[model samples]
Target: MIYVILLTTIVLYAVIAIAIHFRKALHNSNSHQINIQIFRTLFLIVSVNIGGYYLNYFQVLIIIPKLGNDIMAIRKWNQIVGILLNVSAASNAPILYFTSTEYRNAFNKEWQTIIKLLSFCEIAAATSIEQI
Candidate 1:
């Protein structure tokens, strides 16, 4: 249990530290579209992770000994971060969509590319049929 807590704390700090460092580097050095998208996505991820941790696990830790979890019968410490991890899972697309213009533009460009390719294939098939 202590090992699990230690590992979780280590991972939490590492993730935040790396994200912060990358964000700073992105701001200081490369401000390109892709870089900005990456930085924004990383920020969103960190927010989600921290939010999830706080929502369930952190409260469990604080409330278990300090106060009490009124609803739950068993106060067995859950090794899993939190139920709100699922919240982060569900929220990725919406968060990215709302947060980053580059993400939306890039998404649109990909669909456009696919449509163009399909159209080209259809045109080629039609020309081959005509020749035959």
Candidate 2:
């Protein structure tokens, strides 16, 4: 089931890429790129997951050996894939901060609000401590 899902997704993404690649309208020379490498990161996340699934599937169906080089290699591969998963999750903020002006503005605005709130809390704490 996991294999089917992952294979299907890979096919779907291939189709989408081919479609976009051969789009009817010739892409302008000066194309405005967006998303801050989001697609590449997403593709990495999806593709590496197949390794993790393969490890699980083998363990379930074939009874992966208790200890062997092949099993150890697969386990190591799955571990690496698991860490790759964090790349996509952890990269969004820095990517958006660099790529999107809107994200920067919004982030700065929210950050200011946090700073103000923290300062207010500090002042309140100081006053309360003095009273005590």
- All candidates' lDDT scores? 0.65, 0.62
Top candidate on lDDT is: 1
lDDT per residue for candidate 1 within 21-89, as digits (tens), equals: 566344455555455556567667667756775556665666556645543533444424444556765
Model 1 — which ten-residue stretch has the worst lDDT? 73-82
TM-score of 1: 0.41
Clash count of each predicted structure: 0, 0
Q: What is the TM-score of each candidate against the true structure?
A: 0.41, 0.45
Superposed by TM-score, candidate 1 places the C-alpha of residue 56 at a distance from the truth, in angstroms, of: 1.7
Q: What are the RMSDs of all candidates, in order? A: 9.1, 6.2
